[model samples]
Target: MSAINFTDVVFQTPRRVCHSIWDGLPGAITQTRAMRRLGRYIYRRFTRHTVRTQSHYTQFMRNPPLLDVLARLLSEYQIGSTVKLASIGCSTGAELYSALYVLRRARPDLKILATGVDISSEVIKAAERGIYCPGQSAATNGLYLEGRPELFWEDAKALRDLFEVQHGGTLRVQDRLRKDTNWLTADATEGGLADTLGPQNIVLANNVMGPMDDSLAEVCLRNVMNLVEPGGYLVVDGIDLDLKTRVLATSDFKPVLLGQEELWSADGSKDGWPWVRWGREPLDRTEPTWELRYSIIFQHARV
Candidate 1:
């Protein structure tokens, strides 16, 4: 055998030890209030200097409760025959398509105009094609199906309505879902984005801000908020809660409490806990201002 690689072994040992400690902890202990507080403390200490990677991961119906609440809000509050929606940083069009499905299913009579925007030309092309192949990496095919595999199962007839199963197990977005939908390559952080897209009735900027630097994320959040029409809604998540709270406090937006908890616990936003830079903290209701801090959807005050 070659000489013992002590340097590599030493580095690997710490990871193994950390994993062992994590795995050894019981759910009872790990899920306790004290443990959660400790976890948050550790996360804050380490992630203060961390820089997050640009993620293109996405899935269909990643947050059903959010979409349901959005549809309900539109049906109740919006007084128009035409509804416009824009999904900024819309990775591979999965979330956008899911939103369209929910809105159309809820109110088929209304004319819906939807746009999916992403900075990557590659993802924009994939969104336009609307094709997802099985067993491919998200970077390769622009789909992350592992977390929500049941959505594609043959037995999941209701969820299956969203896609047309093609030859060799590929899924093509159905015509109904594709109709009146446009995909554009655009930088959401750039100025004049609001002018370019016009005011949208519902602007979704979810699962995209967490990886950005805090100051940049704040700027992007404000820019994205400007895309919303005066009375329209902005559905955002996956950012620093403190930053969000501060920004919303200064803005004319009010948090919508409907389905707030459900959206917080949704798949993409829920997992990894305090370890990953993009991971969300546990929803702590004991905090006095939990509702405003935890809510993922907010409606702008109508001028």
Candidate 2:
């Protein structure tokens, strides 16, 4: 049989077809075929983009509102004096870089070590290179308007100068870069997290919970909580869980509803395109945090 070009096949149809025919043997065969076709479609999409762009657009979002919320949450807790920050699902290093910039501006005197972990070696390599898409820089610059007026190019140069790409594969904040900040690639639930971060002041898990299954998300959260100092902060955005049940179980956690100024750019620049302040009402304390709102911030209570 001649192979069909998967790219020619559309995305929505297969997902629909798979769901529509998920019962009988013939239906199962159809579903299996659809899944293979879907995989090829995704592969084609991945191959068409540069690794850096792929990392930026696919791996994660450099959520401005979430970053601002983090900075505010840290200040509320005075995190700079106590907690170093660790980021889970830190694809291509934007989250770490964002945290570093916020911390530097918010608390220059304090030492901050940022560790960025991801499951993908490809993402880690792209992050180590420290390159960013032009649009990404523009977006970051727009987000950081309150602290630094410079363009994203200047910000990128500042970041490159401040952070050191260690030969050991860890990205450390060295010398002029505040000396205390750092980043690494590892599983958050695995053995090395403790060694890499010591104890964390703030752990930022942004928009990562939804991709993993429910059980994995909970385990990941527990791992992050384990790293926090008692009274240390845990800031989370884009939680993936049944908020009603999970929030009840995790009573110590507080949900933060971001105000417009805290999220959208008042300057009305399109540079921050998709990040424009979308009002996200807090979940009923049970659904996934991100499902109802575009973004949210959470604080882990002192144990």
Candidate 3:
């Protein structure tokens, strides 16, 4: 296998498209060129589309047991009162909603403060809509459905007729958001996250550490640990478990693996968009590469 070369495309395609689209209809080709360059830089220089595409693709992917993995992780955490779970860089709210679904099923009584953080206004708005593309229901596996879609669909019609407007279809879920769950928009750096979440019972930094600055990662973990009360747990994705080991060693925590077997079939890791990661590396498969191939659950040791 060889590395896929995106460099040529990165350098040439954007200009070609820029010339093709904004060549005539522009007051400022200079500004359009700059914007197009920035767009190309984002899309080509990194795995920008991977997360967006994965949110939809997971419905079709057979290998990744997302709900099961989450259930295992939550069960391992054994969350209690004042439980807080943050999914850093949670784009489009799939992973956070997925966790919410599992938590609602496994421990409905637990007071959950689920916060989803993202930088994109468009994606956040999509999340607020909460009406997944009919396929997201697969990720839920019908775990915590309060009523049939028919019932909700009827309510949507009634609301439309009574109010003479369309407002409360899926967006109603955002309104019905538990007092504990919040959607925040902020940059992960600049101390925004440090202020929002504190010593959480379970903090999910899954797939976030790998893409962020090391200092940001440290601050993020430190914030979670600082907020975490004694006996509280911090859950991180195993993809960066090795790096986390180095970082955690300096802090006051120990590694506890939430087994990968139940979460992943023995043959190989299942495929899906890593709700918060770049793309999976080609050489990622090997013995117990749950974090690389699937999601891994880890608990924070004391302090």
Candidate 4:
């Protein structure tokens, strides 16, 4: 065999042992506040640098609670018949379409104008096509290798309603769902994005900012905020908690406390904890500012 890697040899056994212990702990013990806090500390100590990849990874109906909250917010807050929404970093448009589906189902009377923006032209093009094939490679479709059509949804009826199954199990987004939706390729971190996209009643920058360094993520967060109209809502998740809290502190955007815990511990996010850089830490209610730290949705106060 070729030369062995000393780093793996030195660390692998200890890591495995730690994982075994963690897994062996009963839920009752592991769920305790003290234990959770300790786990968070360990995670922070060992967290790796987030690698920014062009991998367009997403899932349909990823967070039902979040989508339901968005539906409620739009229904209660928006006035006119037409509602404008945007999804920055809309990879393959799964989240964007999911939002559209929920909103349409929730408020059938309102006409929705949606825009999906991504920095990758390839993903943008794929999103516009709205066709996903099982086992398709990133080279052909710009989707992550693990991105399968079946992962789009668990409910068969819902999948049938949203997509038209093509030859060989490929799924194409339905025409009604695709209507009035624009796909544009642009960097969310770049300035003047607000001017180009105009103000939106709801802006989503979810599951996309975690890979960037803090400086770039902060810049992107601020730029993304500009796209939201005053009194509108911003749905953000999967960014550094400290960065999010720090940036929003200076702005008029106040956290929406409803469903804060549900959103924070969302199934899509909670499972990755401590192991992945983008993973979310356990929610700690003991923290005085827990509400601000856990809330993923924010509303811009009207000037």
Instruction: State the C-alpha lDDT per candidate.
Output: 0.78, 0.49, 0.47, 0.78
Please, what are the lDDT tens digits per residue for candidate 4 over residues 223-260? 99988898899999888787888899889899998888
Give candidate 2's total backbone clashes: 9
Give the range where candidate 3 is weakest over 10 consecutive residues by summed lDDT. 142-151
Query: Model 3, 1-303: lDDT tens per residue?
Result: 112454555456654454345335444542454444443344344433243222311111122354455555556444565467776655556556656656666676667778876655555554555544331232232112212121133334433311123344232333333346777766554464665655566565554455445566666656545544555555555233345555655655554435444444421322211212342322223425324333344444554
Model 2 pairs in collision: 83-201, 84-201, 114-182, 242-286, 243-285, 243-286, 243-287, 244-285, 244-286
All candidates: TM-score = 0.84, 0.53, 0.52, 0.87
Number of colliding residue pairs in each model: 0, 9, 6, 0
Ranking by lDDT: 4, 1, 2, 3
Instruction: Write down the TM-score for model 1.
Output: 0.84
Best by lDDT: 4
* Candidate 1 structure quality by residue, lDDT tens digits, 110-222: 88999999887777887788887644433444423223232344433556788888888777889999999988888888898998899998999987887778888998999
Model 4 pairs in collision: none
After superposition, the stretches of candidate 1 with alpha carbons farther than 4 Å from their true spots are 1-33, 77-80, 137-158
